[model samples]
Target: MIQSFRNEKYDHKVEILTPISGQDHTYALLATYEGLAEMELQNKKMFEDEEYKELITEFFLQNIVQGSMTTQLFRTMTGLKKETNSQK
Candidate 1:
């Protein structure tokens, strides 16, 4: 799923990956700014709380397929394309 939101005068895109095997959910948000870069550089955080997972799940559902081609391009560049393909 993809979601777009404006931050710091630049539009940011979020891509959420929900695994079919019940693994921890992962997401990547991309934007043309240092803050986004910093977020990407940070260590991955996994959510064990049901409420947190539900919140994130709802967010992803609302934002699904709402992003532009550029977001998809970034997802590809970030290696999610390959990961998606392999998962299928």
Candidate 2:
């Protein structure tokens, strides 16, 4: 499933995270977009993809817990620049 997302070449970053300490049974798929517009566009593209739809129907819908998914969005604070190696 992770590979499917990467292969699609969407204009966003995707990461898969597993807990080191808490919630051992939980895994997370983190997708970072430039903004809400990008998120919506990418999501639409993803949903419209036939491969994605097949995977969701064949795998995710069967294995994942019903209603267990949750979504949260966060924005970086304005004026905060990402720290680079050169600035360290």
TM-score for each candidate, following the candidate numbering: 0.25, 0.76
* Candidate 2 structure lDDT: 0.80
- The window of 10 residues in a row where model 1 has the poorest summed lDDT is 1-10
lDDT of all predictions: 0.42, 0.80
Model 2: CA > 4 A from native: 81-88
Residue pair clashes in candidate 2: none
Model 2: per-residue lDDT, tens digit, 16-60?
789999888898888878899989998898799897778767777
Which number leads on TM-score? 2
Distance (Å) between predicted and true CA of 66, model 2?
0.7
26: Cα error in model 2, Å: 0.9
Candidate 1 C-alpha error for residue 66, in Å: 8.5
**Which residue pairs clash within candidate 1?**
none
Model 1 agreement with the true structure over 46-76: per-residue lDDT tens digits = 1444544666579767765545324432222
Clashes of each: 0, 0
